[model samples]
Target: MANTKAKAPPIIDFAPFYGTDPTARQDLVAQVRAACLDKGFFQIINHSVPATLQDAMFTLAHEFFALPIEEKLKVDANLNDYHRGYETFRSQAFSGSLRPDFKESIDFGPDYQPDHRYVQAKHAACGPNLYPASVTNPAAFRTTVDTYLAAALGLANDVLRVLALGLGLQEGYFEGFATDPVATVKMLYYPSQEPVAGEGGDDGERGINAHTDFGFVTLLMQDDVGGLQVFDNDTDSWLDVTPIKHAYVVNLGDCTQRMTNDRYRSGLHQVINRSGRTRYSIACFHAGDPEYVVRCLPRGIGGEGGEEKYPPVSVNDYLTERTKDSYIRAEALNAT
Candidate 1:
């Protein structure tokens, strides 16, 4: 048992977490600066979520997914007024240049009251959740999710502070924008499937297609089943983002990249299910409200916006445009 656990997924070694020396954090700041400038991605240690919590979330999410297809489909997105509920792997057709993510996901945005259900032309968020009375352990599931989400909030807040330090801003520079942000945690499951070439297509037809995150920051806790890959902007290559014990990988989103005026970067990558076994992960996104307008960051020391390559626009418009392109081009079609 020990050997098997030892051989499990390889954890990411973040440069910021080497020693316990108090001043060591200064070095972490420097590391974060360099990482955000180059890749806008990093792995974190000492997150509030314990390893046990991570393990439990994965187990419960997978158990929920193992239900019959018909049972799971009962909570389909279209059925519920809100887009909450179960989504099949291929349904998204991300970018339409490859296969839909082989993994099925349960997506739930922030819950709201009927009177407060809002859909501004400038935002993509609104409405309530589509809960399936069918989930046998709904109470346990809610508790597990609530705990993980709280941890996510805590960690995201810390990361935002670190990002401020990285950007040479006061610690709370991003605090205002963090107000009532649209944070989401999607539980996903990728059942063991045939290898790509062994099955069909060079990239696994059933796995997640290449795409960049759309919010401020996206964090993922993945199982040992290794399939996640990240685009290395420095090398222009795709490398597997190894999962680390007691760590979760965090990446920048388009909205943030835009707001930072290119000081940060968003990456594009895909997953291939050659692991030949089932896998599970929880992806948490800390995104701005859709109505939020993204403009160039204050271009002082680390800021650069010579006329602002990207026009000031609401993330809602940007995401809607992107989503339309995603559906139109369809999978395996040229990227927008």
Candidate 2:
């Protein structure tokens, strides 16, 4: 006997969205809407970010992570007022899962000046990022990362415009929410898995616990070594999101789900790096303006005359609560 299940998510091409043909754009919109309603996950191709930039960022990540532990600790994430610096392995645990995730990561958010309003106010998610002095080429690393972040943000804004059109709103419907958005980029490294002693198997250590993104949307770029999985609600099983060259795995987040009154879901995903080689990935998370009040859209609120399914809430408050629960020792919340 053999088992059968879906292994990959739908892959969508963005060419149609950029063409002059109205029909093509409409078709693209339809596809996006279906993907959102079905799995809340999809792979996008033809996004404008350059391959050279992606490669450079990945190289920089490898260099930074390969540094000695002591050297890498100069700018520890724990010491930062805002959660922006290097996080050691096994420092984060999913809310319900007591086991710490088996990976290390570095987090960065919108670059703010020391005297900027948000930074001055000690906003939980806004401040200058910490860069490690131990890196061989600190200048190159910072330049590459900043360039990548800018490109990712541009892509996110475009995607949101398409989504707004898909939902029957003006293309700029989401523009207001994106102004000075809470955009964060995280570089993650998962080392090869090791066999556990006195156990029948590898003990199933997870690179990251199964959970949904807490923002409006997330764009992920993974290396060829695949270990990411998305939970399939309809089949009650996990499906691998295999890496595609030059493609980004896009998925909506809690804010988008709530804003759509559950019309669009926030898929639950986890990472398990079983590949003999180490795995690295960069995730760009975009949420609406922190102070914006999120409520169900008119089109999604009462489809076909039903009542609104969600209550309005502030984005900052919602993200703050979720982040506190996601990390075991979240001193960053004190700033809020």
Candidate 3:
């Protein structure tokens, strides 16, 4: 994390979003709109996800990462085609110019069966997830992850409703986009690092490189050991995303920006763990339905407007292209 004294992003009380009061809900919508326009990042407090569940998820993350590399590889993501399961450290370079990220991760998504429509249609990200049977209490790990995923997706949906209203559209405007969504629940482990010694080392190596997310929105739960930083386009500097107790750090993604013709900023961000201890975070990337065509909305263009900045694209194609670009870099590095 940056110095504790540094400026922090806005933290909104999300309870109002679910309340019966229309005024309170609109107030939240305005706050969210401002945050998205200004920084593309904000923190949400008083969310409905249980603290106990969050704690359990973190516990599983710790336990899973502590296992020997051999054991972790049993559920390697490469085993499947849908990009689920374990990813080794230095396996990705989000910025393309920097060294590969120094973090390990495990990803899980909605486990659709072979007969399911999306699976049958061969949607790029739809398939059964790879669960690590090698973990102690494997059943607990699976159950905890599934339980938290459902809760996180619910919260993401509520946030989407707020976003729709914020854009001057109906609250249900985004509901259709969310059907049979492509939600990824990922656990990231950033190992402690010693400062780099040579030229460019100060900013070259990273736990994860600078990049905007690829989906509709990201809801992240990070532990106290924080190294997350959001880029400030105004100052051309990075601002640390400080950890907040029991709050999710929500941010917009490229797909959302495209759908809104850049009305919602999907800002750049990266992680660098200098805390001298491991850092854990759970990020749920909600990309909505694979088949939904992402087109600019009338409200997103505004009355004073210019022409649409992006052409129509399906959620599946966009996500697949981005994921393919990322792994291509990883594969190049792996071969060296």
- Model 2, residue pairs in steric clash: none
lDDT of 2 by residue, 192-218 (tens): 887568745646478997889988889
Model 1 agreement with the true structure over 107-167: per-residue lDDT tens digits: 7666654666253322454456665556777777777777887778667777777777777
- How high a TM-score does candidate 2 get? 0.91
Best by lDDT: 3
Candidate 3 lDDT:
0.88
Q: On a 0 to 1 TM-score scale, where does candidate 3 land against the true structure?
A: 0.94
Candidate 3 C-alpha lDDT tens digits along 190-257: 99888777875685678888899999999999999999999887667899998997899999998899
User: Which regions in candidate 2 have their CA more than 4 angstroms from the true location?
Assistant: 1-7, 195-204, 299-305, 329-336
| Top-scoring candidate (TM-score) | 3
Query: After superposition, which runs of candidate 1 have C-alpha atoms over 4 Å from their true positions?
Result: 1-22, 117-123, 196-206, 301-305, 328-336
- The CA root-mean-square deviation of candidate 3, after full C-alpha superposition on the true structure, stands at 3.2
The local distance difference test score of model 1 is 0.70
